[model samples]
Target chain A: MSFSPLIVRLMETLRCLPGVGPKSAQRMAMHLLERDREGALALAETLQAAMEGVGRCKRCRTLTETELCAICSSHTRDQRLLCVVETPADVLAIEQAGSYRGYYFVLMGHLSPIDGIGPNDIGAPELLRLLDEIEAEEVILATNPTVEGEATAHYLADQVRRRGLKVSRIAHGVPLGGELEYVDGGTLAHAFAGRREVTA
Target chain B: MSFSPLIVRLMETLRCLPGVGPKSAQRMAMHLLERDREGALALAETLQAAMEGVGRCKRCRTLTETELCAICSSHTRDQRLLCVVETPADVLAIEQAGSYRGYYFVLMGHLSPIDGIGPNDIGAPELLRLLDEIEAEEVILATNPTVEGEATAHYLADQVRRRGLKVSRIAHGVPLGGELEYVDGGTLAHAFAGRREVTA
Candidate 1:
């Protein structure tokens, strides 16, 4: 009635990807099998290598093959400014934005009490210890704009303040090129509350 | 300036999938490396097993680990009615529809002169030989509703007719749930020309 066992298994496994459902999984499986077997093989090898070799960076907790991730290990990056983010994807996003020469600390997740995630679980304690050990003068809270992200950022700010370090949250405002009419109420309110003088 | 070499390589390799652009490929790579490492390992193993083991079924040219695909080897399926199609995805689509019970002959492609595809490339000679060797009573041309598909169907129909075999094309018409207003003119004309009398 359906595909052979291996084909069915492959399709099911492909659904593990983010935003992929059954139909998309089927399409991807067929495409890999039909057009790019060599690419599929290479992907499989890369996945294996990444899984078996990659682990959390000792300093920042981001994924890397070595003890420290590329960002954490680089000597040229500014160690005085630390950007705290919720996941590796956020690190990549900030990197792609073509700004920010500071170092990063990947929390890997935010505080979700319902999901049993606490400070220690997301490496918050390790982050505190690393902040104490490092010469970081400022910490930037760059978690996503969500309830849990806000909670995590507040918690981190309190902890960093206790350690006598300057803590600043990333500015919440309308995105660049965004029209005020289309901006959500929460963002509009934040923009109004955090208004700065037009010194320029 | 970017992700580590391994991460970069993984992201590049993931772009081989259809519809997966650079951003999506990066997302997939980060997801595999960060959250679901175990799932990624399993996917890698599965991909390897599938690529190294799965091959075309000798009888119908559909993908299978064995000499014959499930449909080709199954005795319960009606071998008398053969459905010809382009690609294994078409076979899966028809199977999901749950109406067809006949066996299939997967051509893997349509005849496209512009791209240099010919009858031999689609295994038409093998199909003709199989038709002669089997007890097939009717052949169904189920290629897509494209110009190349129509040409391939006409060619196959002529070949089958020369062997004194009956051939019928899958009907072209407005889909069962589609509105006539949205239906294209070519399909509307085909529906009108292929009109049948209602006996009721």
Candidate 2:
């Protein structure tokens, strides 16, 4: 029902994006071909360049154009404190917070046996290989607070504790500026359980 | 706060699409780079090919890879009944209805004086020239019901009527399956005013 095959292909290709649905894909195709062809061309070029060039950082599994990611290459970063997270996006999120100075180990996904995802599927073997090379004092479990994420964290903790390394989970608590009444029950319980002594 | 310049550029370029914000752009970039590199490459190729190859049909201004659009070139379509719409997306919508065998003249935009978009800006001159070549019996205005659309339709009607060609506007009414209570006042009024005699 599209105007042309190229147009239809463009629309279909756009639907591969994370959240773009059929309607939004149609709108995007129309808008690009009509008003922003130059921008669209730029997007295409950049997309191709990135897809061909970017690869996982050998050390941390974060996406990079080179063998190692910026954090992994930087000598100033704390090599002893490795942050374990589920994806490269978490690495970016932590970087934006401007607090963490450690290297990262990106799992890319959590252990999901039902979906056929195992420890090796999410780069746990790679992480283990790197851990053997680097003298790490502590490993931070920064995976998401989902059921699968918790399971992954427990598994990683078990593996890391076998090497006698310190393990710490990023605290689950009420978000800053969040109202207590509106917080979900699970999060509220986690916040209550993980409460620390009030400081002056 | 991203990993690499190319990745950042890809994310920024993706934001050019309508309704895509920073967060979604980030997610799209991550998803494409991490999970679907081949699909991302295909999308890039399709986008580039489409942007380069697709152009306005010489006859009716719809997008095409060739000189004439499919509808305009089709002998079965009612060439004498030309439908004017604000965008190629509208043409697709009409085509999807499985009705409207008439050709289309895509305006691409409407008159928006505040934004400096006028008659000429939206290819009014080209439309006028096409009108002279085609022996069209009627020109159907299917522009949106917005203020700008109404003004554009009125202006087009005035211009088309001077050629002694019949000009008709598509009816504005409560949408199919929309409740009367939820429908806007102006649309309800238009629906009431344009009411027709009941048929058996």
Chain B TM-score, structure 2 = 0.84
Q: Quote the positional error of residue A86 for candidate 2 in Å.
A: 1.0
* Candidate 2 per-residue C-alpha lDDT over B40-159 given as tens digits, one digit per residue, 9 for 90 to 100: 999999999999999989877878898998887788988788878888777766666554667889888889999999999878999889999987988877777677877888899889
User: Which residue pairs clash in candidate 2?
Assistant: none
For model 2, the stretches where C-alpha displacement exceeds 4 angstroms are A174-200, B174-200
Give the distance in Å from residue A144's predicted Cα in candidate 1 to where it truly belongs.
Answer: 1.8
Q: Candidate 1: TM-score?
A: 0.85
Q: Provide per-model DockQ scores.
A: 0.62, 0.68
Q: What local lDDT does model 1 show for residue A8?
A: 90
